[model samples]
Target: MSATENGWQPAPDLPPPSSSVGIIGWIRQNLFSSPLNIFLTVVGLYIIYKAGVPILDWVFWSADFSGEDQSACTSGGACWVFVGQRLSFFIYGFYPESEYWRINVLFVLLAVLIIPQMIPAFPHKKWLGWFFLVGFPIVSYVLLLGGSFSLPHVETEKWGGLMLTLVISFVGIVFALPLGTLLALGRRSDMPVIRAICVGFIELWRGVPLISVLFMASVMLPLFLSEGAHFNKLLRALIGIVMFQSAYMAEVVRGGLQAIPKGQYEAAAALGLGYWRSMGLVILPQALKLVIPGIVNTFIALFKDTTLVLIIGLLDILASVQAAITDPAWSAVAAEGYVFTAVAFWIFCFGMSRYSQGLERRLDTGHKKR
Candidate 1:
């Protein structure tokens, strides 16, 4: 056996595997593996070149950025000048010019609080979370709607644009989440009365269109209330949006709750945890994490639906855009106005989507088979 007669010999050390394995292999496997794939890749490249080039030209090369009026748009391309002219209106609506600093401060405070909360690695998150949830809203309200401070009182009717849209969506989501979770739990309760009430509330709101709900809040709600009990229009709209969205959220949360295994509940109970403790400490955390995508989707939908407030005479971003384009100077450039509005909405919605994806990845505990 020691004789070199045995033909078995180690293969010569292959040259170190090529570094092309990183990107080149990936391209080969994904884009150019088969003849059909190669053809498709070429076709895709052609399509991109054809479509993307013109879009780039229009947005960058041909678009008008300067000048005060439509006459500045000489390039037979998009008249972005109109957007620039009415930018303030698009952002702040008819918010009083003198009080613009208050809005700016509110935005700064929001960013200061919210950015840290979104980042998981930030320290003292619990305290930050409490402040963001409990304190920020009070400060924001006082700043925006001043009656006590020497700051002049700006009527709710004066609130419009992106600010109003954000106010509605943010307040709606903040209130709806807890309410929805409770409704979901109640709907699954052992007690008949609580379950029945929860079921009815969810179904009633879910059955009606949001437009109808807003209409009821705007017109019918005022009629039902005592004449002396004057409700702010913005408050009425917020209530309607919260109620409408909470029903949808309850259903989404319920789906997540139902997806949990019975063993989880049994295990919690066996650990001597009472109902509230078991659900709050064990069940809800997992349930909510499991449905992060659904929850974020509901939030995105609610944000977009803020535009419907315009129907009730509340000027959200879309309403502000509409108002801006109504000016004869910018009427012809409605497309530009709408595109700006769409981009703004897209930024917020896309940010939410990316955050949800990151959260889902982080919370994934390998409970399910990959």
Candidate 2:
């Protein structure tokens, strides 16, 4: 026996504990204890070499980058130069080459509006509501779609490819958010009629698929209109997407509302805050913050769903790629077109998800600290 300050310690009469006795020892005893591990290691290395070597060779070592046309790419490897040649058309679609700068400016403005909102240090969060929620869209529409002032009118029919996809997704998120908030409030309203109406609206839309909604917009929408009534196809799709996505947005917001403790409501009531005041000042800010990640994910899903517009005959990015490949001159390069589209989609989606993760961290505020 050994004596210590706090208590008696075990006597050092037994052999010292071996380092390789727990997890490391167990691994050595089973995995590397015999000839099987060495054999498996060798087999794994061989498989890696067999698969990776040829792929690395074909993708980069033997790939063609300087070809004038697909015919010049005879190296039995990828021909990425085709993408470089027609990249602008793929991104901007039928948007006039001369007016491509307007799209560029519009994208920059969106980045400016969104990026500042993501940062916690921005001085005027409320101002962003007016600017991004209201001003930017009007400016972008006037600048890109043109017509209102002296700007040349660019018909919505002319919009296609990635530009149309961006437009559709942007409009969906822009409209869905405010609409969702109202729906959430309505669902939680004190009045039975308002609550029932909001619940029915949310559930009905949520029950139906987005494709069905798009179909209704594409087919049934025109029939319901008065004579001589004309609607833009893009606008119709935008409306459908907004309506479908808003239901989902409402549910996400409702989840956030449910997460708020009753103590918060009680405290707000004790402060003599009215319903709207209590909700806006206390409940929504916290609830919305808690659900930011979910909302961003919904937006991402809506962005991807924009591709489904191809089924209804709208030429978004995916349809544009399909159109490109169907051209006889580019038939052999279909794989390249699809790959280019996939890469572009991956870029946009990955960037959005990363931004959402950042927002989650920024707004956590000890509620969900890692």
Clash count for candidate 2 is 0
Residue-by-residue lDDT tens digits, candidate 2, 183-273: 9989988899999999999999999989999999988888889989978788788888998999999999998998888899999999999
Identify the leading candidate in terms of TM-score: 1
lDDT of 2 at 263: 94
Ten residues in sequence with the least summed lDDT for candidate 2 = 11-20
For each candidate in turn, the TM-score is 0.86, 0.84
